[model samples]
Target chain A: MDGIIEKAISLRFEIAAVILFGIGFINLLLQSNLIKKIVAFNVMDSSVFLFLASQGYIEGRMAPIVTNGVTDAANYVNPIPAGLVLTGIVVSVSVSAFFLALVQRLYKHYHTVDFDEIMMLAKERVE
Target chain B: MKKDMWKRFSAWVNGTSEERGPLELPDTAVHHEKKKLFELSDEQKIRLFKAGYLAVAAVVCLAVVSVLLYTVFQLPLFGDPNNPAVNDVVERYVEKGLEETGAVNMVAGMIIDYRSFDNFVESSVLFLAVTSVMMLLLRDKNNISREEDIQEEHERIIEKEASDLILQKVVSMVLPCIMLFGVYVVLNGHISPGGGFSGGAVMGAGLILYASAFGTDKVRELFNMKTFKTVTSTALLCYAASKAYSFYTGANGLHTGIPLGTPGAIFSSGLILVLDICVGMVVACTMYGFYVLFARGEI
Candidate 1:
């Protein structure tokens, strides 16, 4: 592989993350489907993780482990972001889990998961 | 052209109600009603209050911006009096801790010693979140699964079809293998990157498979809601009780607890076993919650 292209390939995850976020954001704004919007929210969250992990990447770095159980900082990337990512992953999962429950509740209450149907139902419920 | 004009004119003459959509209010005296110009409901009034607060906040922000601009040329306000010196001392302490522990995982030392209590608290938080979700969604599945199981079993047994045969054979073949893998992951959590949570999820996946393959009826009969709740709660309580013992007695963790045991050895972290079981239970319960809701055709 070309040197420049290899560097870009290493950054491909961050690029894909941004692209997914943008796509999901546009779809969220344009689409009237509630399920799709929820899915878009999740995609946006995932994009952050992708960007984060990419930012932590370094050329010719070892995994965040000690070489032969000795303190050698020469080959290791920062582990703070990875630890932070673990926390973020947990938060993301919890948010998705709760959101899915709410979606279930919404579907049960409103006959359809479509945004327009939900709005119509809300208007009816209000009256 | 005259006839076409006449037809269009007639429609216009009728005021084009047909052309207008249903939501379009008719411009007629009968449609008019006496109503308040700003009769806000309770929720709307609260929203209006929030809007007012936001406007106030905007003004405050602008005021702060002006103040900051006015003070731009001043030295850094509240500059740390002992900044570099304090950091120099702190770094030395951290370096000493790292050297003494002989564990290259600096973060682990920071986590276990400096902020171990915080981790215990955080673990409790996760346990709470898991428990809350289980408590909320579990009730529906417990009752519904039984009825669904019975209905499905009758259908599968009575039918002598190729698809049924295929599904039965597939499920029977795969369930044992998945279960074994899940157990392997859980048991050897301390040895590798894989741990209780991932292993538990894999185990739960096996149940999901069993449910999907053999039918919900068979799964309900085999596992049931009661079994899940009992085992899950029991597992969590047992984990908490052990932790309580450590907290009270200071007996120094469950595993072979000496100097991280030649790092990457199977018996490294003393707490890994405890961590594994807790993670496994959490994953299993969450997976079961998903399977139950989804199998109801709610998805």
Candidate 2:
């Protein structure tokens, strides 16, 4: 039963990751809307994070602390992944903020948020 | 499915997690169309300009002092433990009688005894910031209708498309609980992870919630410029004077006259209570000032 559950969990993870990446890829290729593409990008990113975070929480491990309230080895999951993820999260927030600000500027310049309209405006400006 | 999986699989490659985006969102329509604002008056322009200036100043300051801030913070959290100059101070005054201070509030003890001056400076900061925000909000603008009924005033702001009912409901429901929890955290600081800093923050959260949910007019009803300034200042001055009194009078220790009732008990510590109260008020007022600045987008 335990082995079956493990297999199911692994399968679920792989399936989710593949679906997320597929959505992002398909949307980028097919969708004309730039905002929709960004949403899809976020979906893919979340799936990758989900995979990393789940793998880090290994079974039967304690949180890092000194054994017997003194220095001795105690079993614990490595905290490096958590630290990496924290930095990644901050970067992601910064990227999103910059992206949105850029979006605002684009909207202001073209007076429209449609992709084809923006292209037309750029062409006009160049001409 | 088995056939698909098994047919000569290649070595798994872990690739870039933050994908290189082929799709740019420059022309992407927002999921919702934001309603257009008709005009920005002269006042709004000034507010926007002032906000921009503050943002620029903050960025420049961070660049300049980032290293100094990092080192100052690091010495306490991750310093050379065995170095004599650093180690001896920790060994004698700090380590000795730490338990006898009967203060389970380690952060409080550290603030009040080790670095009381910094704490005082921080409190003065709260007083000054609050005064500035109040002045900003209540500046020489004419005819902001002084409605006696708060609920009526909130209702009137609705025509200005003040936001949906969800925010008001959320703030009213959550603010009281946050304030209650803040007091609880501050009171139990001695034995727990949280202290006056976090507690006062929670209280500030409550005030901000109320103001955001209702409006600044309702806020004025709740607290006046004069009362808020006077109270916070007096409390802070009292905190400074306590230390000065002890120092100049040649008191043996803070523990001299005060009964150290019982170890680990809340009131057992000599000056921890006073320190906690001061911290709580400072944190609360500082947060309130910040919220006013944020809500009004000035000062």
Candidate 3:
């Protein structure tokens, strides 16, 4: 119990990320609107970014920017995760844009934003 | 005989005129009542199924959250230096990145130098995404010629009405500065936090602002589909070649004595600055391409 408490306290940001992930996941599943699902996907992306960034945190280190004369490993937090997150952000942007484009096409075809209605319409067409 | 029977069966299933007309119910009231009963039952069944699925989804979500929370306890504590994340590789990057890559910004160095192959692939993905979006959204000009003329007229009216004196004057004043800043960010990526992705985005935003304020025609005068294709393809090709050269030399253990010029200088990182420029071009073109394709369905 004590260890669990310590872990929770120390990993507060990670817990926050997990909470955020849960909220986004719930929204994605429960929301019927396609736009809301996209928003939930973004929320999930941010949470994952947060989790990765939090892993690189050090007790009292500066950003990975090398100051005038500082070169010590202890002076800087991990830069790998930060770089990965940067690339991930770009990927997320591209993905969201593509998804939005797809949604636009869907809207044009079905004349509705409701996923369930679209599915039913598609079923009717097939029948 | 089998084929004939199959054809007849399909026609019946598809509600052929002959079958439906001949089988018309004499007691229409009774037929209507039975149809209503089936519809009501079907609706009720669908609602029940949806509710059951929601319940199952909720349970699965709860289980996932619980499992994630439990696993969190097993991971290393936040800000612990002894964690595996801050291991030897990270230490080497922090220490040797400056001397090796000649980039003051370690993140830029790592991205452009250490993991450049990944960045190259990422830029390609962006290019491919824009291509895919274009393929999906772009309409044929000949087919929509009449619609295009109407749209153009409408756009001209909107531009005239919306782009007020103050808006035009302010955007024109700031547009050059925005473009310059983007270039500055890309060039000095090695010395600062800004790099290709951000710099390119800024430039793309500037272009978008120009298009919105002065109209796409004016923006197209400067940057159109032709320019986009040439710039993105050429930049990506150049980046791939440069990275391939470096990778080949390194893998073969041939000491290519290319100097890592003085850190903090604009031309310090031999290929990083060049790569940054290439990436910036690709990203900016993609951003603009997406906007144009989405807005007018062509570029």
CA-lDDT, candidates in order: 0.57, 0.53, 0.88
State every prediction's TM-score relative to the real structure.
0.62, 0.47, 0.89
The value of fnat for model 2 is 0.00
* Model 3, span B154-265: residue lDDT tens: 9778887777677789999999999999999988898998999999999999998888878888888889889999999999999999999999999999875777888888
lDDT of 1 by residue, A1-127 (tens): 5854554454466556666666565555545677788788777788778766655555566655455544444445544445456556656666666666666657756768887668757986899
By DockQ, rank the candidates, best first: 3, 1, 2
* Cα lDDT tens digits for candidate 2, B1-299: 23222221321133322242222223342211111221234347657865786676556544534543333333221112222233343333333324545454444555555556655665555555455444434323541234323544455567236664898888778877888899988776554545566687788778877777777667777665565566577778778887776565445444346565664567766766676677787767667765654344322
Worst 10 residues of 1 chain B by lDDT: B75-84
Compared with the true structure, what per-residue lDDT tens digits does model 2 show for residues A1-127? Answer: 9855555454454445555655555554444466765666666666566544444443455432212322111233333334334334433433443444345446646767666568757976996
Cα deviation of A117, candidate 1, in Å: 2.1
The local distance difference test score of model 2 is 0.53
Lowest lDDT 10-residue stretch of candidate 3 chain B: B17-26
Off-target runs (Cα >4 Å) in candidate 3 are A1-6, B1-31, B141-153
Q: Which pairs, if any, clash in model 2?
A: A35-B28
Pairs in clash, predicted candidate 1: B149-B217
Q: Residue-wise lDDT of candidate 1 within B86-146, one digit each (tens)?
A: 2433343234434543334444433333344543444445555555555444445543456
Specify the highest-lDDT model's number.
Answer: 3
Residue A17 shift from truth in candidate 2, angstroms: 32
Docking class of 2: incorrect
